[model samples]
Structure formats: structure tokens, C-alpha cells
Target: MAGRHWPGAEPLLPRLSRSANHGVLWFGAAACIATFGGSARARRAALRGVASLAVASATINTVGKGAVRRERPVLDAVPVIRRLKQQPFTTSFPSGHAASAAAFATGVALESKRWGAVVAPVAAAVIASRVYTGVHYPSDVLAGAALGAGAAFALRGVVPTRGQLPAPGRPPTEAPVLPTGQGLVLVVNRESGSATAASALIRDALPLAELVECASADLSGALEDAAERCVALGVCGGDGTINRAAAVAAAHGLPLAVFPGGTLNHFAYDLGIETVRDTAVALASGSAVRVDLGRIRPGPEGPDGPDGCFVNAFSLGVYPELVRTREHWAPRIGGWPAGVLAAFEALRGKSPLEAELQGRRRRLWLVFVGNGMFQRMGPMPGRRHNLADGLLDVRVVHGGRTPGLRLLAAAVAGPLTRSPVHAAVRRRRVRLSGLAPGTPYAYDGEVARSGTELMIDKLPEALTVYCPMTAA
Candidate 1:
């Protein structure tokens, strides 16, 4: 192939070969995909692409190249213009460039087929360039590409993609089918992240539906007002805003439609609703499901406390403090930067909370309670496969001197029954007592003060939510 010159290959192949050195070409492609690809799915594809590239590069440099000592192909037959100016000095049994290209392309494809198609041609060009530049043999490129694809599959096995996970376990429920979204009223929190753009998209998709945009302070009233006037209650905002909407919808006995307009729409994403179109389609088709709503109430023999519900998770510890700090700075700066700053500020002088958990007195740094059983996908606690599983996913990080180090270890350890620093359990309800007055806790990104005692439990199949039945 190198000896026989192909038309339009002389100038492009050598430059492509040089550009792919040290995986620069693939990294650039990943960056572009992340920035311009538009959706969360695209961002995930870009992340997976770079992660696969890293794995393939590491394997090729540390193991593949060392396992075989084959030298580079001689440049005698290759044309001068097609050859790379800086000849590779490493063994050529497996082409590192080919490996990186194939891994990135395969990883992206695994997440999103459309993006994979866009990247496939560039990857193929890089692979061809490896051989055209007289740096690797045809067999070497083939072997490397195969190894790279294998690495992507291997990584997926360990950390399954969103499509690979089981669908949310809520049972199908009856809903009013408004094909043009006539009977639905959506409340959009203009202060929430991306709410303005998402509101526009929702408006376009559901032309007949009524939309009410309001500030954060008026979100609850807006949701309640929308629920009173419509057959179905729809909300577009962050988790906290959605939590408020959920309570109103439940009270009004209306099916809820959720549009992901928040910085992180954990509940909406867990229900397989990523874009406004997802909820729109569900509303049009009357496709809906009943999911569990977690509640925190005043425990027995305690002072009267405010009752609240969370669509996602509830936590008491440094995490609540982090949320408080993040909220304080989030309005001044941006969400991501504020979160980073808040983490440092929240943990600096924080101490553990002493409370009686399930009648057992324990010193704890963090207490996390998920509405349903949460699974570990990769390094983090990911989505819930069953939203109505009737179990509280309880995880506790033991109090220690170094709150930062203990939290890091807990995150790294994933879910465990009992570790030295952390423990996890599943229960229908968990009680907490003997707490210091006005202990701060967070539910669905909203921080609040807790009373002396609290009872956390799940309401089985409580809220009917609109979600596309065909979604993965």
C-alpha cells in the first residue's frame, strides 16, 4: 500500500500521521465533540472517547510495544512526500496511533451512534496514515486497532453505559393524552441553570401548552398555580425546583412532566428524561409511570418539625454545608466554580454530627439516604434502576479527623456493607434522634434546618411522572 501511491493521499497522510503523535488528534476531536455536540449524551461520548484513548495509549506503551520487538518498516518503497519528517523510534509491532484512534472512535460509538459515525472516518484516516508514513506495517496497525477496540469493550463491561442499565422500575400508569400538549401547564424557573433555553425548546415542542416563567422565590407558587389550572403539571428546573413541583403535583393528584433544565437533573435523568422533547413525547402519548417519593418527617416523641419530600436523595453532614456554601457563592460566580470553592470552604472547619441513628449513637461525618437503591456504575454512585424499589439506600461515612480524606475513601470504595471508614444498608425507614438543635440537612440540593429527631422513609409508587415508555 505504501509503494503504490493513491490519488490525494500524498499531502494528507503524512500530516495526519504527524498530527496523531501522542494522541493529540484524538484529544482535539474529543474536545470539539464535548464543546459543540450540544447534549449531555454528546458530552458523555466525548468523555468516554478520551477515557478509552488513555487506556489504549497506556496499554500500548506499557505492554503491547514491550511484548513484541518488531522494528519499523523501511521507508525505501514509500514516497518522500508521504513519509513523516520525524520518524518514530519505538518498536512497531503495534501502532500506538492506530490504537488510540480506534479506541476513541469505538468508545464514542458505544455512547452515541451518530457521533460515532462522524468520528469513524477520521479514525480510519489516522490508521491508514500510520502505515502510509512508513512507520508501521499493515499487520501492526490491524493488531493495534483490534486491541484498542477491545479496550473500549472492556471498559464498558466495568462501567456500563446509560443505555446498558436497566430502565427505571416504575409501573405504567394512566394519563391524559394531549398530543399537542394542550392540557399540560409547565412552570419554568427562570433562575435555574439553562432554564431559558430549555423553556424555549419546550415552548416550541408543546405549542398549545401554557408556560409560566418565574424567579426562584416564586417557583413554588408558580408550580401550585400551574397545577390548579392544568390536567398535568409540568416543571422545568433543577432538582430543588422539581422537588417543590413534585409535592404540589402529588397534592393535586396530577401526573408530572419533568424537563431537564437544571445544572444536574438527577431525578429527571434517572427517569430517562434528558431533554424537553422526552417529556413532551411522553405527554403527547400519555405515557407515564408511578415512582416513589422520599419523605423526611418528625420522628415519634420529638418536637413538631416541618415535613419535606425529595425526588432524589437526602443527606445530613458536610454535604449539606457544601450545598449551603455553593448556593451562597453560586449566585455571585458560576455553578461549577462555586461548587469547587464551596467544597474547600465547607470542609475546612467542619466537624462531625453526633446523632442517634436507629437507636445507635454514632459519630458520623455524612449520612446519605437515597429514595431507592442506588447502584455504582463507575467511580461514583450512579442512577437508580428501580425508582419504586421500596428501599432506602443508606450510606454513612464514619466521623474522622480528616473529613476530606474519609469522604474521598468512601467515594473510591463505592457501596459497601461495612468498611472501617464507611457503611451502607437498605431499609424501609431509618430514624435519627438526639440531634443538636437546628441541624442543617439537604434534600435534592436544597438545604434546610432539621429538628431534634427525623424519620426518613419512602412513599411507594406515590408520584405519577411523565416519561417516554420507549426511552432506554
Candidate 2:
């Protein structure tokens, strides 16, 4: 194994790391300080520059990780692995830490040619940390370095080669448009599920897949109607449409996919596919890996107990409000602005209800349970909260007013699970109560079923995913 059997970080960070793995992090850290650290003032400047590069690397990597959840070697069934450190919560995709270090070293090198010699060696050393620590494959480290350097150099466009820092709070620019193929089938959302918008996306994505416009007059007919074709199902709507599309695809065994055309394309990001172009190309070019899906049964919805199926995160409370808000605004503007409008729209609704999940009783303001992954920050890069994992990341929220205002603060800024304002709760199964009939509940992004009770459970390894850039 090129990657080593190293000691863990909690123990390693403080001590002279023992052998088992020696070359990477030890030398990497040493090189970083030695090459970058100079006279007191010069070293301070280098440290600042390095830190900036690291932050930039982490941000871009995080988004890409969410957008490209490459599976880790940990997923392999064989026993060639021995974890030397605490396993990261993330999968190994475009290594964030390494990329950041590489970018930092690269940036510092650009500042001085003499520094360049030292910087390149140190950057290479840092790349060694991941593989040497046994947390990443050799390939993982290399890709991370490449991405980090790219992001660092890219930031220069915003910050300038020698001056002016980049603007804060600027979301990543729209995904660069790509020339797509000429075959596409557009799914339209006439009902709240976004069949109509999907049709528009298909109009635009015609070069990608063959388009067939499908819509449910309402939530009830969408799944049955959309499942007719077995080709890859690409949804251009929100969680609801994705749910309906996924349910239809799950039953039909057709590959299900997504475009961020809806309220939140949690499934798309989890799969590491972004933009219609990203989705179109990935579906056309990527291979299929087995993945899990979530199924739900409603106590008394208009549909057969199964409210729907989900390939991404699902939740209650605020999530439903989030969807409802978007539904109200989709006709006006179809992107993040609709989400922003929806946040304010939710403020017109009710407060968190007291409820019981699986047997635990608690008062909550909101609850979030996801299938793919969850990051208030768009996609959680490097980790797929795999629907196939069979476990839902359940979160319970309470004590926040949905109608009070502050859209961003109310949307992702708050965690239903942890907050003095809310009770952080996690469970495998849940029974909800203390709400009115027709109280909106969300599964993926399907329209809220006006039901009083819901029955939910985790189904493991339910779906297969195609990961092209995957590594050990």
C-alpha cells in the first residue's frame, strides 16, 4: 500500500508522529514552515498568504466535493485497509486539505522565485500527508493538489496577482455553460413539482438527452405518468419533482438523475453532478454504482400510503415550508431568487409543532432528514449521504419562527438538531403528531401531503451511483 498505516491525528498532532507512516505529514509540515517561514515580518506575510490559499482551497473543494461525491476506498469490501486516524466525516474527493496546502505553497512560491524551489517541494510533501496517513489514495492527493492550485490561481482573478482581496459572500459564479449533445427529453412540472420548468430546461438541454415533456396535473399522477421511459430520468425541478421522478424510476429500475431546476437539488449535488450540462454529460458518460433510495408511507394521503421515493435528503417542518415557499415563487423567477422569496414566504406559516419520533418525545420547530447528504452550504463535497447507506441524517428543529423573516438565516443557517432554540434529534423511524390535517410534510421535493401522520424508515444500499473520479 503506497498509503501507510499511520497513528491517528488526535494522538499524532501533539507528539513526534511514530512510524508505520513517516514520510508525508511530518516532512510536509516541516517543509511548509521551513520554506514559508522567514524573517519575522516576511514569515507573517507568508503565513497570511498561505492561510488565505487554504481557505480558498477549502471553500472550492467543499462545493466541488458536494458536487462530485467521489467514493472513498473505505467503501471497498476487501480488508486491505487499516484506519490509522479517526475516519473523516467526508469521502476522499479532490482532497480539500491537500489542495489548500498546495494552493498556499503555490501562492507563496509566486511571491518569490527563491521561495518557489522550497514551495514546490513543500507542496509535494503536503500531498504526501493524505496517502501517508492512509486516509487517501495516491490519486486522491494528486487530484486535490491540482484542484487546490487551480482554485488558488483562480482566486487571483478576483483578488489580483499582487493586491485587493476577493469579495466576501460571493456565491460561486453560475456553472460555466458547456456545449451539450443534441438529444434530450424534457420533463415538465405543471403541478408544483416543476414539470413545466423541466420542460424549459429540456428545451435548453436538447443537446444532452431526448426530451419528453411529462407532468402530473398534481402530485398524484406525476410518478405513474413519468415512469413510462427507462432511459436516465433527469429532473429539472426541486426535491418534489426529484422525488416523483425518483419514485417512478425506482419502481421502473431506470437510472434516476437531476438538474438543479427545483427548490433544492440535494440529490444532484450528492451525486457530484451540477448544472444541466454537468448532469447531461455525467449521465451520458458516467457509470452506474449501486445506491440506496428512501420510501415513505403516509397514514392517509390521497396517494397509496407511499408519499414518494427520494434520492437525496428529506425532512419535515422547515423543509416543507422551504418547498412551499419555492412553489409560490417558481412562476416568477426559477433560481435561487425563488428560494430567497420562499424563505420570506414561509414566514406567513405556523410555528414548530411538538412531536414524537420513533418513541422519543420532543418539541421541535423543524426537522430535517436527508437521503443523499446535507450541507446548509449547497452540496457537501466529498461525502454522499448515500440513499444507499440505509441511514438518514435525522435532525429536529424547534423554537424558530418561520414567518419572522431573515430568509438565509431561516433556511440553512439553522440546524434543527442542534440549537438552544431547537432540540437536536436523530432517529431511524418516526411518528409525527401535534399538527393539523393537511399539515405539509416533505419527502424529497414532492408536494406536501395534507396528512396528519407519517411512517418512515431507512432502507439501506437502495441505489447505485456511477462515480468516475472515485479513489481510494
Backbone clashes for every candidate come to: 0, 55
Candidate 2 C-alpha RMSD relative to the actual structure: 19.3
**Model 2 lDDT at residue 393:** 59
lDDT of each: 0.87, 0.52
lDDT of 1 by residue, 1-472 (tens): 8888678988787888888888888889989998777568888999999999999999999999999999888889987877777788899989889999999999999999999999999999999988877888999999999999999998999878888876666788879998888988989999998889898898799999998999999987888788778999988899999999999998899999999888888898888888888888888888999999999997554556457899889999888898988999998999989999998987898889899999999999999999888886111357788888889888888998998888888888854567888888889999999998789999999988777889999888889998898752
Superposed on all Cα atoms, the candidates' RMSDs to the truth, in angstroms, are 2.3, 19.3
TM-score against truth, every candidate: 0.93, 0.51
Best by TM-score: 1
Give a tens-digit lDDT track for model 2, residues 253-331.
6555556554345555455444455555544454445566665666654335445666665566656777777766776
Report the alpha-carbon TM-score of model 1 versus the true structure. Answer: 0.93
